[model samples]
Structure formats: C-alpha cells, structure tokens
Target chain A: MASVNRPNKQQNHPLDDLIRKDRIPHIWCPGCGIGTIFASCLTAIKECVATGKNGFDLDKFVMVSGIGCSGRAAGYVKLDSFHTTHGRAIPFATGLKLANRDLNVIVFSGDGDLFAIGGNHFIHAARRNINITVICVNNLNYGMTGGQVAATTPYNAKTTTTPAGNAENPFSLPLLAYASGATYVARWTMLHTRDLTVSINEALSKKGFSFIEVLSPCPVNYGRRNKEKPLETLKLYQEKSIIKNGADPSELDIDMEKGIILGKFVDIDKPTHSEKYDKLYRIE
Target chain B: MTENTTESRVLTGEHFMTGDIACAEGALAAGCRFFGGYPITPATEIAEQISLRLPRVGGTFIQMEDEIAALTSVLGASWAGLKSMTATSGPGFSLMMEAIGLGLCTETPCVIVNVQRAGPSTGLPTQGAQADMMQARWGSHGDYEIIVLAPSSPQEIFYQTITAFNLSETFRLPVIIMTDEIVGHMSEKVIIPEAGKIETVNRLRPKGRKDRFKLFEPDPNGVALMPAAGDGYKIHVTGLTHDEKGYPVMTVEAQAEMMARLTGKIRNNIDRIIQTEELFLDDAEIVFISYGVSSRTCLEAMAMARSKGIRAGFLRLITIWPFPDDQIRALAKRVKALITVEINLGQIHREVKRCAEGKAPAYLVGHPGGTVIPPERVLAMAEEVL
Candidate 1:
C-alpha cells in the first residue's frame, strides 16, 4: 500500500516537503543537538512511510505534541498533527490512536513535558502499553520558555529557575519506560544521529508502546548559560555515557550528575491496551 | 415525514426499562455506529446495550477505562467520520470536562449523554437531580458555545438522542443530551420512529480546489464547511486559536477575530438552534416552565389545573442552553405569573426568572435532591401564583 502511493520524483518527497525552509537557522543556536535529533526523526518517519508494514497509510499517521521546544517537532511535520495543551500530548495521542487503531500516532515531547508536568500520563500510557511511539527529547532545561531546570536536568546544573544549582535529582527516561511496561525502550544522543534514526525506525516498527529518549542540547538556554558550547556539550555526553547494551536493569544506577546512556535498552512482547480492551469487549 | 406504524407500535410494547436503556434504543435508531464509553450508572445500561447491539450491526463499541478516554475516543471516532457518542453520570461527566473542551475547540461533532445524578462530588449516584446544567455550559476551560437538550420521558429520550446528534453535526459543536437518573432509568413505552422519518444532518464539504478551500472561513451562513481526513485537502487542524486556514496564529488580533467568529455563529443564530414545545401558553393566567423529568410532572399538573378551571399552561424546553429566553419572556408578558418546576434547588429556574424579568411574578417549585416532586407539589406552586 505504501509503495503504490510513492512519488516518482525526489522533489515530491512528503517528508522533505514537511520541513519549513524559512524557519531554518534552527531555533537552537549553532552546535545545539536539536537539529540533529530532528533529522533523525525525519529519517525514521520517512523510512516508516516507505517500507511501513501493512502499507503505511500517511493519512493514518498523526503527531501529537505538548508545550516544549521539542513538542514543536509536530508542527514541522506535514501530517495530521496536534499541538495540545501543556503536558497533554500523550493522552491526546492516546485518544487519537484508540479512535482509529489504524493510525500510527506519535508523541513528540520534552523532558519537562513528559517527566514533569505530564509524568502521570507517560507512566500510564506505558503501563497500558498503547501501540503508539513516544519520542522524548531531553534537553535538560526548559528551552522554549526560559532557562528553567527540568526533571531531566542534570543535578548541580545551574539555570534561571535554579540559581545556585539544581538541588533535585534527575530521571532515567529509558529505565522509567522499562519499569512502566513499555514494549520497547531505547536512548540515544543527538550526536549519534544515525544511531538515533535507527533506534527510531526500530521503535516505529515494533508493536505496542515504544519509547525513545534522545538527549538534545539547549544551546540558547542551558548550554550558553552554563558556559558550555554545543561541541563541549556533545563531548560531555560522549565522555559520560556508558555503552553497556543489554545491561541488567538492577545493575544500572542512572546517576543524576552523569550524562545520558545511548542504546536499545528493552524489547519485549506484551498485550497492547487496545487489544486487551478488544478481548474484554468481544461482541456477543 | 410519514409515520411508520410498524416501528412505533413495536417499540410501544410493555417492558421493564431504564432511562439509559431507552437512550440506547434512541441512539441506535438515530444511526449511531460507534459507541465509546466507561460504565457509570445509572447510565451503564446504555453502554451494555451498545456493546451488545453494535457488533450485531457491524458498528464499533468500546468500553474505555475512564470517562476522559471515553469522550476522547468518541471525538476521535467522530473525526474518522463516524457518528459517535458516550454516556456518563455526574462523576464520569466531570472527568470528561477537559475532553469536552477539546471536542468544542476542534469542532468535532459528537453526542454526550449525561444521565445526571445528584452531585457536587458523588452526591447521590442512585438518585436524580437537574444539577450540572450550568456545568455543561461552563465546565470546559475556554469561551465557546454548545447545544444542550433536556428530555422528560422515555419517548423523549429516544427522540432527543437522535436530535442531539443532528444538532451536533448541524452546528459543528459538541451536543449534550442532559437527562437525569429519573428519566434515564425509568421504563416507559416509547414509540420509536422509523429510519426515514428521522432527520439526519451531515457536514457540508467543498468542491473545486482543495488548496483554495478555507475550512474555518464561513460564507454568508455562519458555519464553515468541514473537511474529513483522507480527503487530501492539506487541512491543518488545532485546538489553539487559529485563522480560517486552521493554522495556529499567535497574535491577539487573530485571537479576537477567531473567537468572535466561533461565538457569533451560535449567538447570532440562536433562533435556528433554540427549541421549545409550547402548550396552552397563549391565554393563561399562570405559566409553568420546566425541563427534563420535572417538565413531565408539570404537564400532568397543568392538565389537573385546567380541570379545576384554573387558567394555567406549561412550556417544555427541549433545548436547555441557548435558553429559549425570547419565547419564555413573551409567555411571561401574557401570563400573570411564571413558575419554574424542577428538581435540585434552582439552576435553570434562575435563567427562567432572568428571562421573565418584571413581566410577571416568578416562583420556583424545588425538590431537594434524591426524590422526585410529585405533580401536586408543583400544582400548589402554580395555585399560589394563580
């Protein structure tokens, strides 16, 4: 079904057409990791549209977002997209998916939107194992609003909201996703764009709730304010991230000060929320 | 429309019934193909009936985990071009407030049947009340207009269910069928109309260039044409304040203009939306205006008053919100007194009195919460006004 509708001309690429050229000189300053992550997402979405299992219908694909800079990714996409209220993209997408079951609903959210204000929905959607892919963009601080410390912000990282340093501990999104019963959980940095794209493609292919947390850089917000340039932040992630794939869940100690880990963490089969609902409500 | 005696006679058979059950039959007859709901009684029977019947008819029925998800799924189904609905009581309805707002903002046409039970917070699940009348209007977080209908009998439940869907599609807004537990759970003989007899409303679509089309841009009529998904229109839809193109706009100027368009469509066209059934109101010394189950008792009391040579009449409001103020105000001028009969202390009665103004003396016949007010009590209030 997907091949039947493919455009013969390269210029007619739907995914490429979705990107707004005028809005370029990307929102983040030079060396910021968001641009790289965005590229990876575009690649993943393109691949899904190309070789999508069950003839990936573009009309059935919807993107839901919240109120963070990462959430703005939905706006850049040329599909049925919704930028919902703060911390509400997951539930909104949940509704959109259940409404059709044919739609491939994706949620684009930031750390603050997913783990802080919208934490409850994230955990529940994971637990329910709804068949939607959630790509969480972790840029440490609230970039869109101001330089405010977030739930994923590194401990002792200074920001406008946390003057001296962030006193609170941060979270491990992949570990949380694993605990919440997500069928697939992975983490990658924007620096590893190819790897991130591969991870996204893998998540999009799998059934049930798949979560990918990408560590992006907030050059304008946290990066510059912390006196770290884009390259320095990328180096910091490189030095701190552990490459321990298939690591034991109990053995992993995600330190607040330590940088993000990058790799596929969990992949398992579980009955999706809607499928379970179908079983319970089998017609007489 | 020719009345189908077969359908009417068959549906009038004596049977034990609940108001929720009657609503389910009403929805089926009204062409409801999708049902998404969380079980909340005295409204659970509606879900149960849909679960059983939908599959038989090749329709979709889902029992969502919560009321929020239930309403959300219904909205989604509606966008997929299905006539979708959900039913809930006070508690579930409260949970649905946010999604209800989403439905309003997106202009997704769907029906929400609130089998209203007493509540401020689980006040009385098994009991009935006319509370939440104001909540239905202002529960959501934004400024928008909605159509709300109130029905008094099993017959009204079936008919109103269909009318709710029609109004939702006709106006491109979320429509609420507000029925209390008394009317929802009561089993009464209802003459169901045949398929062709019932009027159905479908959204208008634009022809010509899809790129040239303006979704939110209305013509001389207030309603803009709606485009369904898969139509290849490149339509952009959002919950945020948007221009006619349906793209989000960030200026106050844009906000004011769009809000005006949305609210004005309903306010300016109130006459086309407001519905009220007038009975003997032309020449009466006293007029009793009521809705929901209370209005049924009001009718019986009005009949008893006429037998006693008391000049009294009744106005049964079919549409609650977009209150039939013009007609009520006119009735108040002709009648010596206007009395409101309702359960719950006084919610819509306030609206009635506000519309009545100084045209006549207005009084209330209030029932505390759980119990229904018999016809005699309302008659006493009418007698006092007379």
Candidate 2:
C-alpha cells in the first residue's frame, strides 16, 4: 500500500519529508530527550522501510499521542496522526487499529499521560493485547506543566507538586506492561538511541501489545530542582546500565543512584484481540 | 430509492423486538459496519444484538474496555470510512462526555445511544427516566451544538436511530439517540424497510486535487469534506482548536474562527436537524409537550383529557438538542398553557417556558425520576392546567 503512494521527492533531507518541517524547532527545552526519542522512532521507520522486512507500511502508519511534551510527536509525524485528549493515547490508538486492520498504530506519549490519568486505558489495552506499539517517554516528572510529580516519579523526589518530596513509589513500567499481558516489553534510555530504534523496529514487526519505556531527561525542571546536570544524569545512566535480556520485569525497579536494569525483558507470541475475536466469530 | 426488500442485515418483515434490538438494527440498516460498545444495563441489549448480527454481515463488533473507549473506537471507525455507533446507560454516558466533545471538535461522524436510567449517580439501574435530556444538550464542555433524538417506542427508536446517523453523517457531528430504559426495554413490532428504500447519509468526500485539500478548511456551508486516513490524505485530527491547516492555533482569532465553524455548521442548519411530532395542536387550549417515554404517556393523557371534555394537544419532540424552539414558540401562542411532561423534574420544561416567554404558562408535570410518568398523573396535570 505504501509503495503505490509517491514519497515526497521535493525535500532534500530524508527525514525532512517525513516530519512537519514547518512545525520545528519543537517546544521541548534544551537538553530535553524527547526530541532524541522522536528522531529515533523516525530513523527506525526509515530503516525498516530500507530493510523491507521489518513490517513498516508507510501508508498504514499512524501516530497517536496524548497531551505532554512527548505528545507533540504525533503532530510532527508526516503520517496520519491523531492528537487526542490527555491520558487517551492508548485507547485512541486502539480505536485506529481496531477500526482498520491496515493501520499500524504507534502510541507516543509521556509517563504522566500514559500511567497516571490514562492508567486504566493502558492496563486494559495491554490486557486485551491489542495489536499496537506503545512508546512511553518516562521523564520522572511531568515536564510540560513545569515538573509535577507523576506516577513514574522517583520516590522522595522533589517536584513542584511534591514540594516536600514524593511519598508514592514510582511504577516499574516494563513490569506493569508485562503483567497486563503485553506480548513484548523492553526498557531503554534516550541515550541508547541505536538500541531503542532497534527495539522500536522489532516491536513494530511483532504482534499484540508491545510496549517500550524510554527513560528520558527533562533537565530544565526535573534536573535543576534535583541538582543533577543533563550530562551528569546521562553519565549516571551509562554507568548504572545493565544489559540483561529476559530479566524478570518485577525484579528490575529503578534506583537512580544505584544500578538500573536496561534491556528487553519479555518477548513472546500471543493471539491479539482482533485475531482471537475474528477466529471465534467468523461467519460462513 | 425503492428496490427489493432483501438484505442479510435488514429484515423487511415485521418482528417483535425490544427498543435496544431495534436501535441496533436501525444502525445496521443505516450502513453502520462498526459496533464498539461496553455492557451497561438497559443498553447492553443493543451491543449484544449488534455483536450477534454484525459478524454475519461482515461488520465488526468490539466490546471495548469502557464506555470511554467504546465511543473513542466508534469515532476511530467512523474516520476510517465506516459508519459506527455505540450504546451505554447514564454512567457510561457520563464517561463518554469527553469523547463527545472530541468528536464534535474533530468533526468526526459517529452515533451514541444513551438508554437513560434514573441518575445523579446510578439512581436506578433498570428503571426508565428522561433525566439526561439536559446533559445531552450541555454535557460536553465548550460552546458547541449537537443533534439529539428522543424515541418513544421500539418502532420509533428504530427510525430515530437511523435519522440520528443521517444527521451525524451529514453534519459531521456526533449524533445522540436519547431513548430511556422504558423504550429501550419495551418489546414491540418494528417494520424494517428494504435497504435501497432506507435513506442513509455519508460525509462528503474530497474530490479534485488532493494537494489542494486542507483538512479543516470549511467550504461555504461551514463543513469541510472529510477525508479518511490512509487514503494518501495524511490528515491531522485533533481535539484542540485549530486552523484550516489542521494545526493547533491557540489564539483568540483562531479560536473564534475554529469554534464558529464547529458550531455554525449545525446552528446554521438547525431547521434541517430539528424534528417534532405535533398532534391535534390546532384549535387546542391545553398543550402537552414531552419526549421519550414521557411522550407516550402524554398521548394517553391527551386522550383521557378529551374524555373529560377538555380540549388538549401534544407536541412530541423527536429532535431534543435543537430543542424544537419554533414548534414550542408556535404552540405557546395557541394554547392556554403548555404542560411539559417528563420523568425527570422539568428539564425540557424549562426550554418550553423560555420558548413560551409569557405567551403561555409552561407547567411541569414531573418528579425526580426512578420510573416513567403515569398517564393518570399527566392527565391530572392537564386538567389542572386547563
């Protein structure tokens, strides 16, 4: 389907044609990792197309996002995109996939948008194993609205909302997705651009609900308050990173100062929602 | 539009069905191929019927996680070039309010049926009420307009549901079928017309240069031709106030233009969207104005009024959101008083009063609802008003 539609020949840059050039430079602050994550996904798609084996159908591509700094990724994509309300990217993407089997819907959203208000939709979509790829940019705080403590915020972290300090424990997103029936689950940082892109490519090629959590930096708000510079934080991530595939997601919780598990944890096959539904209800 | 009365989905012959079943059949008859819904009492039968009937006709039926996802999926399916619908009760309807706003803002055509039971917070799960009438009009936040239809019986609901889809498609808005638990659960004979005989409306599609197409740029009539995704359109759909380029434009000027187009598309053609059934309203002194289940009781009340030598009339609102303002205004002048009968205490009655505007007194014959209004009680109100 994508081969029939002519690619944009006028633009000089390969990615310029794929992104809304008029909308750049984006609203993300300097040292923000959201842009890197966005570039990774775009590069990944381009690589998938070049390989012609990673299942990237350009015409069938759809980007859906909720409200946040990362949510702007949907508008940046040249494919059919939906910028839905806050905390609704999963369900909205679910709608796109279920309505048209042809669409390869990718949900790009932030930690607060995906796990806080949109928690129910996230768990349910995973539980149903809806066929879609979800990319969660975990910034440890809500960066768009001036760094409020989110569901993924580290315990005892001082955010604007948590002036004294966060009392609640942060979520291990990979574990949440794995337990909720996601067929593929992985964790990577924005610093691991190549690996993250590969993970995205693999997830796009795979079936059922695939989730990739990208531990990203929001230095302007989260870092300045915590006294960790952007470079220092990236150094910490590089030092603490451990590549252990098939690690139990439940046992791999994040401790910023301590070692952090960073690798693909769960990957298996399962019949997706529409697959099982059609099997059971197909008519003569 | 007349042809053979034969199709796998639409049954031509008469059959006894509940309002829920009739609503589902009505959707299928209107060319709806996608059914995304969640189970809620008094409205679940609609989903169940669709789940059973849709698969046979090569249509899709997906029971979503919640009513929020149900309506969102319906919107998604509609944008994918399939007519779609979903059904829910009060609590679910509340859950769907946000999606409703998104649908209207994005100009996504879809249908939502709220088989209303008593509420404030699940006041009655199984009993019928017209409590959500006001919510149907003003439930979603923002200055926007919608088309709401009220069905009094299973047969009427069947027809009204079809009309709901037509108006939704034509205007590119989310149309609501505001039937209650009484009408939704009531079993009655419904006549299904032939497929070609049924009038179905689809959103206007883009023609001419695809490059010239602006996703949100409205034509002279204030509605842009909707282009489906994956048709090489690469359109951007958002809930935010946006420019004709479909880019978020958060300014007073941009908001005014965008919001105007979103609202004016419906308001400018309210006459085409509004439908009301006026019965024996001519040369009558006492008027009964109502909708949904309450409309049925109003008829019986009007009949009982004539038996008591009282001249009474009734105006049954089929279109609830456009509010049938002209009909109420016309009836207000010709009658001594207009008695508004509904299960909930005077929701639409306020509209009747505002429309009446001292021309006639608009009296409320209602209660805080858990059940349908009795004909005797409505008749007694008519007598008192007369």
**Index of the highest-DockQ prediction:** 2
Task: Estimate, for each residue in B180-264, the C-alpha lDDT of model 1 and write its tens digit.
Answer: 9889888877665556777777777778897688778876667788765545564556777788877777799988988888787
The best candidate in terms of TM-score: 2
How many residue pairs clash in all the candidates, one count each?
Answer: 3, 0
Query: TM-scores for all candidates?
Result: 0.88, 0.96
Whole-model lDDT per candidate: 0.79, 0.87
Please compute DockQ, using alpha carbons, for every candidate against the native two-chain complex.
0.30, 0.61
- In terms of docking quality, model 1 is acceptable
Give fnat, all candidates.
Answer: 0.20, 0.58
Residue pairs with clashing backbones, model 2: none
| TM-score of model number 2 | 0.96
Error of 2 at B152 (Å): 0.6
Name model 2 segments beyond 4 Å from true: A1-12, B1-7
- Candidate 2 lDDT over residue span A105-153, tens digit each: 8999999999998999999999999999999999999999999999998
